[model samples]
Target: MKITCVGGGPAGLYFALLAKQRDPRRDIVVVERNRPDDTFGFGVVFSDATLDNLADADRPSYGAIRASLAHWDELHTHFGGRVLVSRGHGFSGLSRQRLLAILQDRARELGVVLRFEEEVSDPGEALATSDLVVAADGVNSRIRERLADRFEPRIDVRPNRFVWLGTTFPFDAFTFYFEESRHGLFRVHAYRYQPDRSTFIVECREDTFRRAGLDRAGEDETVAYFEELFADKLRGHRLLKNRSVWRSFPTVHNERWSAGNVVLLGDAAHTAHFSIGSGTKLALEDAIALVDCLGAHAGVPEALAAYEAERKPKVLALQRAAQVSLLWFENTERYMALHPLEFTFSLLTRSLRVTHEGLKARDPAFVREIDAHVASKAEAQSGVRVVSADAAPPPPMFTPFRLRSLVLENRVVVSPMCQYSAEDGRIDDWHLVHLGSRALGGAGLVITEMTDVSAAGRITPGCAGLYRQDHAAAWRRVVDFVHARSRARIGVQLAHAGRKGATKRMWEGMDRPLERGAWPLLSASAIPYLPESQVPRAMDRADMDQVTSDFVQAARRADEAGFDLIELHCAHGYLLSSFISPLTNRRTDEHGGPIENRMRYPLEVFDAVRAVWPADKPMSVRISATDWAPGGLTTDDLVALCGMLREHGADIIHVSAGQTDPSSKPEHGRLFQTPLSELVRLEAKVPTIAVGNIQSYADVNSIIAAGRADLCALARAHLYDPYWTRHAAAEQGFAMEWPDPYRSVERYTLRMR
Candidate 1:
């Protein structure tokens, strides 16, 4: 297969390298506008996972990139004097020039012909030269425009104007500094590119740009403005631009990505707003995928079909996120003027790729602690999730359930996880695999983990929440595909963990938050999960009522999200559970006391939730069934509690165990607490879904067979095998609908059947 990649940037070079690797005999040429040494941008950051993807596709190149990487483990967020440094953000800061040089060398070594300083304006040059022409000319790709009607380019000019500049200052970590200059809330994303210089990208919304008159300002003037914005941090290190050739990057997005023999790759296909620092990653990844598709498929049309089909969703998602980042930066005036904290959080979320649930894996402590914040308990960010028959499988676990109107099928669920890979709060390529494969696994129900109800509810500095219009739009592709591709039902689990926060990630040591118990935990009563955790503030009467309403309103929003079932997280030691657990509830008010009293606030939460939840659909409650501590709640307590929940319109009782008490020793084992689920099933007489360590086909079938529970949820196992459901069906000789794409794999006629 012969291939011609236009533009010598990361995408083209990487694609050329990948193509040659796929077929050494294949003639591949990379045409660039600049010399081998010449390149734009300062540095590009790639996470550990991105490296793994590269390694998976082309290990030699992966090893080469890794070998040359300037590694950084921690990401530092600057808020004036307060510096929040969190570890394990996992990015290697390699300069654009360095990245190109490496790819240039790798492509050359891999037998890729690099034709530098060759500006061919016509597609005929690509057509005449190679079997396939990749339209990777960048954001303003003329090849894509020539076949504009074929590609269907939906060019969305982003609002915020940003300049990608470099500096010689030693920036070892990714630093986001907010400046409330007369220019307004200008945020600078500065991170190390080389050992001496850092890539300083000055990003500001349209309002700030206009107010500062940056458009009219000369290149040096903009740099001066940014220097003033980071006055003390710069430490006299000068910021430099390639001003001899003027460039202020306008974030570009295209609706239609590929057409005919020519296909778009990288920034030419889609541009991720600079906030998330993944422009090059997207391009390189496209190159990798296109090559694999060419190798995998038999011919050009099929390869193109597969590549476009694969890359389109990915590019669109990234573009949507870029749009969000662009809009958020452009709308900074709105957030900065009214809600600074929210603005900052929104910025963090916009650059992120994965959903809120992913944070549990990436940085559990951050997610936990954020769930413990004030807005978290307010219930404004969580509510009932709606799912239509038209809705696709969310993540992997999706099922058409039936309880009044709520229906889902399948038991596997992609527990919500966050890919804080965003610069601001947008989804990107990382998000696609982070989500799509989970759906591909055939889980009946994949509920996105606890998505922050509001931007502020996001755990860590990086949990992605759906609190804005751009958020909804950004997620549409994710939700749409899960529904279209699989039988799985998709739903978003929204949560606000109140006051249980302030720490590094889970792997880092899910530590007790900053100020420990001093950050004022808000609950029905003044109770702390532990002395090291925050000492929760006793909720005043006003707080209680307001929180109840917040839950209601958030639920309404969840309905707008088009989720299928609404699961109010009254479990996992979050705020709702705080009110239910005796260990945390010390109040004598209507919201606390005996089981009945303890049930009040949570019930009020449920009732408020019920008022907004549809009368027809089934509502579910996930509870810590047993608090484990003797004086806390008992299994009997959960049964009664579940009975009450059923009375309040909850259809499924998702039974789990402990969290509130520090001394609670959970009896740990495989399906150790399944008996508790049995009790909840028989006693409560409501459909019960059992979770925790139920990891096999036998377990799922037996649990449902023995009537211990109506459904069995397999979480960790699903992660281990996304296609577990398919494997299970084949094991059981049950005919399941395998996706059309994989049907060929089913033909094993050598004697097995």
Candidate 2:
């Protein structure tokens, strides 16, 4: 079999060497448009784990690379007139030219042909001639462009402008330098890759670049400008250039990594943002995975499929994390107002890959200092004196949070989870056990699932409701039990299913219309929730009035049932949410079209409910911060909506995302919705409850301590462990009150701890 690799970068060269080593008789050739000695960029960094993989794959090249490496274990951040050094983050860096040289030599030694100064404009010709064609070209790959439709590449050019250059600074640790200029905030990422040379990449927003005249400045002039801007940290070092020019980082992604006999590798297939420093590492890892897959499979198609199946998910995860880090740098100004300690911490954990516990493991003393600082501030704000300053206070999750007149014992909330066990809008034993158990589990607040406002508003026949007197009486029984048995405050989420109504039970087939007894639906527009679902009648003035009246009546019942809080469920493609999302609400009347018009009806409903509900009790609104689809609500739109809600007497905003359309693409992961919560909380200056995949106490602590959200809601985790909060308190060694009946058990657990 003959294999030809395009563009002789590390990914292509390494693959040539490994494939030859795996099969000595295999014919392999690496083609490059540039000379063997010529390369762009200065140095590439890798983690200790990556070094281990390299050593296992090919020891001689790994040894050569390791000998050339400049390693460090400290990350220094120079910010706010102070330098914060965090340790135990091991990284190794080597000059890109040297690394490529080593791979080129190894490939030649393994009987692989290297062709320099040869460009392949048509990858299809190479694919036809050879058994396999590997496109390992850089971010702007000609072969990828030639076969763009087959691969379906998606390239996102980031907002900030960055220039990659080198300096003779001799930096011992990976360093981040941030400076505030009249133009905007400028940041530098520098790390030593040789005894005397370091990679220095300066970055700033586009507005800042234009303000500083960097867009028009020559390469030397740009370097000079950055040198002056970062002079304090750079000292007297000279900045060197190698075709370094101001440009936005293009994050490349391919829907299909392979088409026919051709496959993409490294930057050609995907590019993670450089903020995480994983571009080279991922490229090499892809090379390794491709070689292994080829060796394992007999057919080229099988090998390509297996390679993509194994590597795509991992690359996507890293890309997602890189995106988070990129966004953090783009919006650094938002966190500039934070205290220096928190600012430094936020910088260190920007990617969300690292956690408070993980940081503590790496550098216990540093984490302890941060904990002490946070505890001091928390104490000052709460006026709750710690019994012992010598002992570290409980984790921030244990800290009490105040919402208007209500003071929660902790920041943990049991997010509303639908049970679909109610009968004709009346709560049954299943509802009682579900809500009552979480309350007993020691959550600060327990919110009921989307309880319909009227019979026609339910998503299914089993959905709980607050419309009928029987429904109110049934809910009162459960609420009374929780009030008597636990200190947890309960809230009711009053919702109208709108176009999503007349669905079968979730266990049977969620959102599917019932074979019989399916009622007609209504929404802001005459649209169906899905292609097969019922087409909802466009709500007229009478329909809006009745819905608003139903919500007011539900609020009255919720109050009478002794619910401590009321959350208007206007999210997740519900009735009010239908009006907010452009994809669902296509009406051009006074109730839709522009965002202001789209928000009109929801605001009216909120106003009516606020007028009827008790003034002292807080009312929260659950909103889908983004539809996660094109031509839908965005974070900016949600922020504006939140501002309007605040003006209309909303006490809190519950932040959730997506489910507005079937085609919506949600970036799912742990704490995925927290960023939306952070934006709304800061931009709108409204307290927020963050819900979605919040799994642990550490997450709760991080979200609260970082000011990302005032409270975190856990759903599935609570279903698996009803005593999640109690166990969290135990794990953190904090004393919490238990019910009288469980006092003995609590005592035993405390003693065991």
Candidate 3:
């Protein structure tokens, strides 16, 4: 079989070499628009794990690349007049020109033809001759453009301006230098790739670049300005340029990686942001996957399909992380107010792939320092005296947090999870054990499940409620038990199920209507939660008034029952949430249409509740940051909604997503919802409690220390272990008080250990 690869970049060259190595009998030729010696970028970086993968694929080229690699284990963050160094993050870098030379030599040695200075405007000639045609061109692929209809490509041009340059700094570590100028913040991603040369990349927001006159400046002037700005760290090193010009990164994505006999590879197929330093790595990895797939599959079409199926998901994951890192740099101004230590931590975890435990595994001492600082700040704010100067400060999870007049002993919150064990909307002993144990277990706060505002509003017959006096009296017993036995604050989440109401218990069948005893539902529009479920009545003025009164009365009862905080349940297709999400709310009245109109009823209900709830106690609103479906709620909508909620006296926003519609495609992963909370906190300038997929003490510490969220609520973790926070404290070796009756158990357990 004959294979022709277009372009002589890393993707084309590496694929040509690997395919030849896989089958020495196969004929292969690589076409290049530039000479083999011509290259643009200075250096490319790779992790040690990537090096291992390369060595397994081919040893000779791997040995050659490894011999010339500049390796480092330390990451130096220079911010706020201080340099913080973290070690054990292994990385290697090599000159891009040298890498291409090695690949070119290896391909030639493997009997693959390399055509230099020959541009292929059309692949028709090669397609007619070769059995397989690979479009391994770089970002600007002529072949990909020619077949635009076949491979639908979407290119998103990012906002920040960056230039790739080299310097003779002789740096030994992966270094990041941040400097605040009058124009804005300028950042440098510098790392040594050779004995005397290092890759220096300068990035800034578009406005900052324009303000500094870089948009109109020539290469020499651009280099001079950056040199002068970061002169202190450059140490008189000279900056060199090889066609380095300011350009915004274009993130490329292709709908189909292959069309007919031609297959797209590397940047022509997809491009992750450079902030994550994954372009070259992804290209090489793609080469390996494609070659392996081709060797395993007998047909070219099957090989191409399998290659994309295996590689697209991995590339997209990294691209998502890279996008997060890109946004962090774009909004550097927002994090400038953080302390230097926290700023360093935030930078390390910007991609969200690096968690507190990930850093702890790399550098335990650095994580300890972060934990100490967080503990000290929390204590200082609460006016608590340290027991001893040398005593280890508590972990971030054990630190005190305040909201209005309530001071939580820690940052861990037991998220509201429905038990569906109530009787006639009245709390029972089950409530006392469920919520009371969690409060005793060491959480700073525990929120009850969706306590409905009215009997007709309940999701099921067993759902808890706050509408009746007996309900308030029953909740008081549980609240009193929590208050008497622990310092944890208790709160109630008042919700009305709306179109999703009258469903069976979760164990019985979630979202399924009860065989009997089902009640009529109400919503912002006459839409059914499911096709088989009842279609709810479109709420009129009277329905809105009655619901508003129900919420207000529930708030009064929640306060009477001694809840320290009140959270309005405006999420998960509930009554208030139905009025906010466009998917569920399609009313033509004043309470629907645009998002502003949809938010009207929810805000009115919030106002009514706030008017009755005690002023000293804080109130929060739980919102679905996104509906995770097309034409549904988006982050932009969430930001606007959060701002409005803040204006209407919400102390915090509980950031959640999905469950607004059944067809929503939510991306579930570890700490999936935290990014939504972080965006809300930064964009809306509102405090947020991140919920969903959060587990472990390290998660709480990382979220709070990085200021991603003011608090973290865990549902599954708390359900798995009511003493989750207590276990975390013990794991961190912090001394926390135990219940008087359980003191003996703690002592016995410690002695056994």
Q: Which regions of candidate 2 deviate over 4 angstroms? A: 121-125, 380-388, 732-735, 743-753
Candidate 2, residue 273: CA error in Å?
0.5
Q: What's the residue-level lDDT of 489 in candidate 2?
A: 84
lDDT of each: 0.67, 0.89, 0.90
Alpha carbon lDDT of residue 60, candidate 3? 86
lDDT of 3 at 102: 95
Looking at candidate 3, what is the lDDT of residue 753?
50
Per candidate, the number of residue pairs that clash is: 69, 0, 0
Candidate 1 residue spans exceeding 4 A from truth: 243-256, 337-346, 351-357, 364-369, 375-753
Q: Candidate 3: global Cα-lDDT?
A: 0.90
Q: Whose TM-score is greatest here?
A: 2
Tens digits of per-residue lDDT, candidate 3, 44-163, equal 999998999899888988999999999999999998889999988999989999999999999999999999999886578888888899998889888898888999999999988999
Model 3: worst 10 consecutive residues (lDDT sum): 744-753
lDDT of 2 by residue, 280-377 (tens): 99999999999999999999999999999999999999998898888888888788777777787888877777777777789978777777766676
